[model samples]
Target chain A: MNLVLHNFFRSSASVRVRAALNLKGLAYEHVSYVLRKKEHRAEAFLELNPQGLVPALQLEDGTILNQSLAIIDYLDGQHPEPALLPESALDRAWVRGLAHAVSCDIHPLNNLRVLQYLDQQLGVSEEGVAEWFRHWVDEGFASLEKQLASDARRGRFCYGDTPGLADICLFAQVANNRRFDVDMSPYPTLQAIHDHCLELPAIVDALPEHHPHAN
Target chain B: MNLVLHNFFRSSASVRVRAALNLKGLAYEHVSYVLRKKEHRAEAFLELNPQGLVPALQLEDGTILNQSLAIIDYLDGQHPEPALLPESALDRAWVRGLAHAVSCDIHPLNNLRVLQYLDQQLGVSEEGVAEWFRHWVDEGFASLEKQLASDARRGRFCYGDTPGLADICLFAQVANNRRFDVDMSPYPTLQAIHDHCLELPAIVDALPEHHPHAN
Candidate 1:
């Protein structure tokens, strides 16, 4: 099976998928699409992903899948090694809750197009856009920190010392947050988890800097 | 097995999970936390879900799981009858893509806190907040319409005739859009799917008006 990951270097969503694939010990080809150049929005790319989003997985069968969360969930289902989810229902829910807090809540607000929309259509100034980005990140991280702080299951990683789906989602977004200069100090637990995930070989290899599109 | 669903009537996330539970032919207990009254933000609820969000499911073993997506996935995993996902990897991805179009992209932007943030902090007028809500919803539906139009697999539902995860999600959010007064004329495919899902006995029973908090 020829698995091709269509992604951009700096896309947090793409980075998360890469981390998941690597952590699962899956070997796949990488196809970089420079999002800044509007490559994802081109007609051919849109044919692959009507949403014109990055981190689309093109299977050997030529089927394309979009949406980072769904793509990762499918990957976890297909490859159970170093299982991304916890063994029990409650634990699985907590891990998934952490992942969604970042994916559905925080990252969605700071998505490239969202920022562009804020600036261009909403007439938000540059500073205003930055504020908008940071505001959401802070709100999400605050709750995430609270959730992680008191949990007995949290180890060196987001869940029980293993780099699960929540860790993948959180690490990528934390990297993005740093790029936007959002403070990590408020969320000590998240910062600790992010630091730990970055040290793992799979995550390090999947870093945005390793991508072809990276400068 | 006693399954308790903690939810808010108008919350799209809660509605999606409720629809799924009902579809699975499961007998569950309903627990209401009124969002408008800020009951979810109270200390006890916060302990259950630090995110202070609706749709936390308590399993038979007395385990609590938060996040609508995760809870629904757990339900599907436990009760495999009338499976929610397609048989193949690609097909599953497509169904999940449809779910994300609403859960990840459109719904997050118009979430209750976000609208409140726009008004209280960003100083957006009520009219401006409504416009922002409608804009993102339209953007997502436009993309979804194109995908649905191009696919022959779409039956009376979002995916292959079954009222699955995607259908449950889209049905709930479309209902929310109506409450927000967002126009739905542009996306005929979405409207069609929404109409079909509402006819299902489970979805009809899961209607927001059926909840205790509904006005």
Candidate 2:
């Protein structure tokens, strides 16, 4: 089966899918989009996803899948070994909730478009925009750290000792946080889980610097 | 099983849960909180969910599930008679993508707390806040309406003929939109789906006015 991942290296959503694909032992071709250069907004990429978002996956049947969570779930369903989600439905919900806490709540607020809009339209100073970006992210991470540290459900990873869905999302987002110089001292459990995830080869390869767009 | 839902009537998330419970024909006791009065932020409620969000479900074991999506999924898993998700994983992903498009993307931006922050802290005027709310909602709904209208996957509902997870989310958010006077003319497919969903008895019972806080 041929899989094409259309992504930018710095995009956390793309990174999540890459890690998921790597974890499943899947081979795919990478097509880079330079988001900073407005390449994703180009007519070519817009045809692939009308929303003009990155991390669009082209399947063997040529059906393009948008949304990182949806794409990861699609891959997980087709390739179950080294499963990204937990076995039980309840466990799955918990892991998904953790993932959403970052993907849904935190990431969107600090995304590239939003940051650009803040600078270009809102007249916010660069420092102000950076502070605004870090604010929402730290709030999310603080809650996540509390949940992970206190919840009995956590293991070496975000779920079981295995690197499951939540671990994949957390690892990628934490990497994004570090780029912004967001303080990690407030989230010890998150740091520990991230450390565990980095030991895996799949996650290591999905690092931002590894992608062609990172330059 | 005795099902009790702790929620506020004005909360869109609570409305979704109420609709789901009604769809499943489960008799649930409503434990309402006055969100505007700082009741949800009280120690008692915060103990249930540190996030202090509405729509926390009290299961038979007194286990509290906080996130609205997690609560809804738990209900679907526990009571599978009238399933909220589709049978195939691909269809399930589609349904979830639509749901998150509203819940994660639009709702969070225009949430009460966030809006309040814009007004109280940032000193944004009432008109400015409303404009901000409408901008994101319209941006999200435009894409969603196009997707639902063009895709063959859509039947009378967001996915097929059944009123499933995505429909529940759409119905609630559209109802909230009315309060902000967000124009629906731009998204006819979304408007049609909203109208169709409201036609159901479950949806009617879940309207914000029925909640304890709606006085």
True contacts kept of each: 0.74, 0.35
Per-prediction DockQ scores?
0.71, 0.53
lDDT tens string, model 1, A143-206? Answer: 9999899989999998888899999999899878766799888889998898898689899877
Q: Can you tell me which runs of candidate 1 are displaced by over 4 Å?
A: none
Error of 2 at A204 (Å): 2.3
Chain A accuracy as TM-score for every candidate: 0.96, 0.97
For DockQ, the strongest prediction is 1
lDDT of 1 at B30: 79
